[model samples]
Target: MKNNVKLARIKANLTQQQLADGVGITRQTISLIEKGKYNPSLKLCLQICYRVNAQLDEIFWISEEEFNSEENN
Candidate 1:
């Protein structure tokens, strides 16, 4: 999955730690999400979207190919 977390956080003037704390996750988790190293659970994704004032699609996205591949996996 892809996410605009870094962009949104910067626009919101929130550090990774601040965002993580607000969403009850570790800063490392936030970093991984920003870098696309980890896929957040639906609940966490919702929390992030809400806290960052972005729509779910604006924050987290899966390309058609990726979606297909994930289904295969």
Candidate 2:
């Protein structure tokens, strides 16, 4: 899944550590999420969305290419 987590965090004026603290995760987890290397649980996604002032779709929507790739896989 692709996400705009880093962009949202920047727009919300939050550091990775601060967002992680607010969402009860570690900074590295936030980094991983931003890098699209980690897929957060729905609960965690909600928490991050709330903290970053982004809607779920805004933060974690899958692109058409990714969706197609997943289907192929």
Candidate 3:
């Protein structure tokens, strides 16, 4: 999945560690999520969105190409 987590974090003026602390996750996990290498659970996603002051869709949006690729896979 693709996400604008890093962008939102920057916009919110939060470092990875700060965001992780707010969401009760590790900095590595936040890094992984920002890189789209990790898929957070719904609860975690909600927590992150809240911390970043962004809606879920705004942070984690699926592009048409990604959706198609996932379907194919």
Question: Which candidate gets the maximum TM-score versus the true structure?
Answer: 3
Candidate 2: C-alpha lDDT? 0.90
Off by over 4 Å in 3: 70-73
Clashing pairs in model 1, backbone N/Cα/C closer than 3 A? none
What lDDT would each prediction earn against the true structure?
0.88, 0.90, 0.92
- Clashing pairs counted in every model: 0, 0, 0
**Candidate 2 at 51: error in angstroms?**
0.5
Winner by lDDT: 3
What does the lDDT read for residue 31 in candidate 3?
Answer: 96
1 or 3, greater by TM-score: 3
lDDT of candidate 1 over 1-73, digit per residue (tens): 5679999989888999999999999999999989878999899999998888889888777689987886676
In candidate 3, position 68 carries an lDDT of 84
Q: Global CA lDDT of candidate 1, please?
A: 0.88
TM-score of each: 0.83, 0.87, 0.89
Question: Model 3 lDDT vs. the true structure?
Answer: 0.92
Question: lDDT by residue for model 3 over 1-73, one digit each (tens)?
Answer: 6789999999999999999999998999999999888899999999999998999999888889987896676
